[model samples]
Target: MIDLRSDTVTRPSAEMRRVMFEAPVGDDVWGDDPSVTHLEHYLAERTGKAAALFLPSGTQSNLVALLSHCQRGDEYLVDQQAHTYRLEGGGAAVLGGIQPQPLDGLNTGELPLAKLKAAIKPVDPHFARTRLLTLENTFHGQVLDADHVAQTTALAREQGLATHLDGARIGNAAAASGSSLEALCAPFDTVSICCSKGLGAPMGSVLVGPEAFIATATRWRKVVGGGLRQVGSMAAACEYALDHHLPQLIQDHEKAERLAAGLAAIDGITVTAQATNMVFVAFEDSAFAPEPLHAWLAEQGILVGALYAPRFVTHRDVSMADIDQVVAAFRDYFQRLTR
Candidate 1:
């Protein structure tokens, strides 16, 4: 199937798979895996952070950051639609005892400085101590720029709050925004970047931050049962992806834009402005259910997502040929709906 569900669906490329198969393995939990250690150090250098910890998933990385940064009954502010707030199953609250204070949507991809300042507790005994401000770049591929990141982080700093970034698709955002990884990551105290999505690594993510912060996060990672043994294979795949796949992310973003434009041209369909590799297409007519359209596309060997709003994502696996097929499928579906 031509999967457009999410970049997380991508399989590792041939080169990545070869590296994984031939990787030198050792115990990572014991800090004896040379390749894993190398991957962590590589990510730290790339992000301009003092240290980094390789984690099983972005969720674990974010959760570990939250646990390390906040004590029980502490709160962190996040955008309402952020992945950590909406998608991470409330692990911050349930496991870390950290409460999430979601800010209302800010269209410009930044929280208003005044609103953020007001969200911070004013040394009150009755309130949950707000200790962290979590920011998400590309809230599902929207690509918030460095200026927005700088302004939001500046506000958080003024309120004495440390910042964490859920940078799952950070490479895509960096490619789209023309921002250096270091410059984009420098504002936040900690940032979790995924290797599996878009980058085509089979599995793994890295949490980067100051050496002191990462030391604490490592403790929390073990406490949360995230320690891995013989994970150098996965780390090797990430290294391969970084070297070979990261440079091609812009092509995926371009394909997403092309898909968005094609879908927008179809009657009764609305496509959001394309930024990275994700595109959200909505059927304007309430009666025009997405199920049949989705079914039709699947029958034509296109594996689209089943989201409530019907989201589509272009990934490393999808190509210009796949984009043409998707556009053709949309044309046929729209014509059928009209008839």
Candidate 2:
């Protein structure tokens, strides 16, 4: 089946597997795993950060970042729709006692500067002190504007707030905007780069930042049960992805553009948004219902994310031919409705 549900579904290639199999291993908690240590250092150098820590997942990376930045009673400002705020299971609040001040944001996934400035507590005992400002790049596959990021981070700095970036798909953002990873990540104090997404690693995310901040995140990671033993193989997979799969993100974006264009031409479909490997579409006209399209596509050996408003993701695992098959299936479904 051609899986368009998410980039996370991509499996490691034989070459990546071979690299993992040959990787040397040691206990990561003791900071002695060569593969894990190399992966962390590589990511840190690429992002121009002082240090990096490998974690099990992006959610843990973000949670550890928040824990490192904020104290028990402090809060962080984030967009309501951001994965760190909405989709990450409230780990920061549940585990770290951090409060989240979620604000409405633009369709671009940026929090309004005025609202952010207004949300900071005035050193009062009545409110949770806003300690950090968090943002997600490639928010729903859309790259955050560079200027917007600079301005937001500057605002946070001026307000005496630390900043963190949930850069799970920063590779896609960098590829789409022609920006270097260092340039893209420079504005934030800390960033979480997920290797399991479009990069095609089986699992892992590296959190990079200043040495002191990374020290704090490391402790938090251990406290949160992220201290894995002999994870050199998984770390090797992530390192391999950085070398081999990171460059392919551009092709994923191109495929999304083609898929969006194809679906937009169909009579009963509205192309809602397309960016950095993701294409979202809405079914138009009351004559056709989107509910059954899920099963229909499944029968055709195609898969998408949502049932009603579908989100089709293009990844290393999905070829251009698969994109054409998806477009043909949508065209056939709409044509049958009209007939």
Candidate 3:
């Protein structure tokens, strides 16, 4: 099937598999994994953080960061649409005993400062103590600029709150915004970046922060059962992706724009603003619901994502040819509907 579901669906390339097979690994929990340590150091240097810890997944990385930053009964603020709150299965609340204060995320992927300020809890006994402000960059494929991130982090600092960034797709954000990864991560105290998503790694995420914070997060990672043995193979894949795949994301963005323009031309389709590699397409009429559209596409040997509204993503494996086939399918389906 020609999968346009998500960048996460892309399999590891041959180079990545080769590196993984040849990777030197040791017991990570014992702090003897040279390859894992190298991956952590590389990620820390890339983000300009003092230290880094490798985690099993982006969700675990974010959860461990939240657990490390906020105490039990503390509150953390994030956008209502953030993946941490919506997609991470309430790990913060369930495991960390923290409350999530959901705020509106601007179209640019930054939370409104005034709204964020109002969301903070006063030092009274009546409310849950607001301890941290979390932000997500490249939220749903839109890159939030550094100026906005700096402003929001400054706001959090003034309120005596720490900051964490859920930067799962931060590489895409940095590439799209023409910003250095270090510059993008400068404001937040900690950042969790994914390697398995658009970065094209098979598994793993790196959590970057001060040495002290990462030290504590490392302990929390173990408590959450995220400690892995011989994970250097996975780390090797991430290192390879960081070195090789990151540079190709811009091409994916270009392809997404090309696909979006073609979909926008269809008579019964509406493509939302395009940014990075995600495209949100809404059918003009409810007569063609996403379920039927998804099934029809499957019959045509295509795989599209089933989201709240129909969603399609461009990734490493999806080429211009794949985009053309998808567009042709859209045209054929619409023509048949009009008959």
Candidate 4:
């Protein structure tokens, strides 16, 4: 099936699998895995961070970063709709006792600087001390303005709070915004980038930050069962994705745009949003049941998520031909309504 559910459904290319098979292996928890070490160093240099840690997932990377930055009872400011806050299973609060101070972010995934100022709790025993300000680079496929990041982090510093970025789709943001990863990450104290998503790796995420902070996250990683033995295979796949598949995300974004345009022309379809490699769309027909579309699309060898506004994701596995097929399927579904 042509899966448009998420980029996370991506499989490593054959070339990536070859590298994974050939990668040198050692226990990562002991800091002896050469492949893992190489991957970490590569990402650190790319993002201009002093150190990096390879984790099993972006969720683990973000959680470890949170544990490293905030102590028990400390709060981190985040967007109400951000993955680090609303998603990721609340690992920060569950594992680190870190509280989240969620504020509504702008359409560009930026919190108003004034709202941030108002949200900061006065220094007192009664309030959860704000310790970090976390941001997502691509909030629901919309790239956050890089200028907004610099300004927000600068304000976060003035408030004596550290900053972290849940950059799970940072590569997508980089491609869409035409900004270097270093420029996007420069203002944040820590940043996590996932290779398992749009980058087409089997599984892995790299969390980059200062050496001291990474050291703290290291302990938390082990505590939370992220320390892996012989993890070079996964690390190698992620590294290969960085070298190969990262550039192709721009193509995925183009496909999403193509899909969006086609969906917009349909009489009963509402195109809510489109950015990077994701498209949000809804059926305008009052009698339109998403389940029927789901079943119909499945019959057409297409797969999508069951969201209120169905979200479509483009990835390496989806070709221009496949995108055309999806558009055709949707057109067929709607055209049947006329008859």
For 145-236, candidate 3 gives per-residue lDDT tens digits of 77788888999898899999999998898779888889989999999999988889989999999999999999999999999999899999
Candidate 1 residue 80 Cα shift, in angstroms, is: 1.0
User: Model 4: runs farther than 4 Å from truth?
Assistant: none
Task: Report the error of model 4 at residue 307, Å.
Answer: 4.1
Provide TM-scores for the models: 0.97, 0.98, 0.98, 0.98
Ordered list by lDDT, greatest first: 2, 4, 3, 1
Error of 2 at 133 (Å): 0.4
Predicted candidate 1 versus true structure: per-residue lDDT over 1-339, tens digit per residue: 899988999997777778898999999999999899999999899999999999999999999999999999999998887889889999999998899999986754578778888788877889999999998877778887677778888888877899999989888888888888898899999999999999999889999999999999999999999999999999999988887888899999999989998989988889855668988877788777677777898899999778467788899999899999989988997897669
The residue ranges of model 2 lying beyond 4 angstroms of the native Cα positions read none
Model 3: CA > 4 A from native? none
Measured over all alpha carbons after superposition, the RMSD of each candidate to the real structure, in angstroms, is 1.1, 1.0, 1.1, 0.9
lDDT of 4 at 130: 89
Which candidate, 3 or 4, would have the higher lDDT against the true structure? 4
lDDT of 3: 0.90
lDDT of 1: 0.88
Cα lDDT listed for each candidate = 0.88, 0.93, 0.90, 0.91
